[model samples]
Target: KLVVNPEKIKSLKDVKGKKIATPQLGNTQDVAFLNWISEQGWKVDAESGKGDVSVVRTDNKITPDAYKSGSIDGAWVPEPTASKLVSEGAKVLLDEADLWPDKKFVITNVIVRQDFLKEHPEAVEAVLRASVRTNRWIEDNPEKAKAAANAQLKTDTGKALPSDVLDPAWQSIQVTDDPLAATLDTEADHAVEAGLLEKPDLTGIYDLTPLNKVLKAEGEPEVDDAGLGVE
Candidate 1:
């Protein structure tokens, strides 16, 4: 967990009692960290404070500052923010990219209502195509994306993000067009494990025939769930 002791400590042998904070417990970062800790034969002893690390929950802004000021160790956060902390002198303790490696570290996703997907599979395919095109556009024009993010932030939060946070934050977002992206499945699996999902019916969860049609017309193979390595 890069949010705490950001070093490549290699094992739970090192992270035993360091204080850590995340947006919330039972979130992906928290659950994944808990899973890792469990593998180490030591427990997350919140009460005893033995292997007892402090788990503080704080607002987003405080997370970076807390890590920087030494009030907290590290945090599970996305880039540009992770990059922001690093540029502001917080190092990359661990990257989710490193944990999963080229598999998406999904911060967000787009989900259409299943009934809609079923009713208008063509519309789903069109959207996925647009999404892919948008991704390519973003990658080619980072500044435009930044400006868009700034506009959104200003509209919603009424302020521009400081450049330190903005620049790296821009880098952290890896936009992809795969309508049936594997990372979606990965997140789905995570959801089931966390009990956020009662159970995921893979077939029910996807309507990839639309995506398949899109891919075929484009001269690409159909979207492959297995290739995404979600399972």
Candidate 2:
């Protein structure tokens, strides 16, 4: 989501000349934001992150503090962090998902070392099965899943998200097994437009057989790899 300080921005046009943040220079969100800015007829130096707008590459964990300190006026950030900024008086001016068809985009995906996968196909299948089952569980019991997720976060990170930040962030997410591969391809194009990447072959970038097998066994529709899967 693109969140802004309500006091500073009244609308998207107001974002011009404002200081905005992304997780890292040349990262996914940064590329997307740069592409959007270019489409708006704005010019920016992608590497230095300077021009019509200031693209501060701040880590998500400290984004809320950056916002509070007025180091940034807004951020193109992922959840919990987005909600945290909202808690600090930021307004969600745009949901990036809405920019894509059907309001769907890739937030995360599983990746494994090719050698490890080849040596342990069974283990790969098991991980995919677990992921599929967890997505289904989240769909079936959202509240319970949220609680479990918070508990796990606390266990792993030593702190849990507060309900005020957790609830809305959880509600905004759509857990799925598909991976939305086409969106990844599109994001690569965004990177190219942002001058962060060159056009290159992405053929055979995915090995979705394990994922499809897990889905088939679970009686769920299989997913495609946007023609980038191993033939």
Candidate 3:
């Protein structure tokens, strides 16, 4: 989520020459923001984060405070940091999902070592089954699932988000078993455009067969790997 203080910044163009905070330089949100800057024909050093806009590398723990203290004009951060900022009178200027096709992109992905997958294919299949089932349950019962997730978050972090912040943030995310392979490729391209990464040859980077098998057995459609899957 990209949020701005409406009093300080009314639009994306207003971000130029302003101080903006990202969790860290070269992190996913940082890369995405840098890429957007490149698209805008603005200049910024990917490593130093110095350019048209002052890209401050701030921790998520302090980003909301930074905004409240008027140190940063805005932030490009993930939830619940984004939600936390919203609670402090920030306006959501953009949701990164809306920038992509189908309003879907990969925020999280499941990975396993090649050796592990090769040795324990059945284990992988079982995990995928559980993942698919969990996604289905979440979709079928969003409010209950949200509460369950908040409970787990509270257990881990010792605090649960208030309803005002949690509701909108939860609504923005779409949980699914699909890895959205094409979006991963696009993100890599974004990193390259932002000068944070060399163009990577990502062929065979995905092995969705186990997930697809689970979906098929459940009478669901298989997801495409965007030509980046193993043969």
- Compare the candidates by lDDT and give the number of the best one: 2
Query: How close is every model to the real structure, measured as TM-score?
Result: 0.72, 0.97, 0.97
Write one digit per residue (lDDT tens) for candidate 1, span 1-231.
354444533344556677666566556666555545555566564322234555565556667788777777666665545665666555655566666756455556567896787698778778977766676678888899789878898899788888877876677667754544566566566555544466665554545566667667766566655444223
Report the poorest 10 consecutive residues by lDDT, candidate 2: 199-208
**Backbone N/Cα/C clashes per model:** 6, 0, 0
lDDT of 2 by residue, 6-93 (tens): 9999999999999999999977788889999998999999999999999999999999999999989999988889999998899999
State in Å the error of residue 53, model 3: 0.8
Q: Candidate 1 has which clashing residue pairs, if any?
A: 3-74, 3-75, 4-74, 6-93, 80-168, 80-169
What would you estimate as the lDDT of candidate 1?
A: 0.61
**By lDDT, is 1 or 2 better?**
2
Deviation of model 2 at 132, angstroms: 0.7
Better-scoring candidate (lDDT), 2 or 3 = 2
Please state the error at residue 29 of candidate 1 in Å. Answer: 2.2
Output candidate 3 Cα RMSD.
Answer: 1.0
Q: Rank the candidates by lDDT, best first.
A: 2, 3, 1
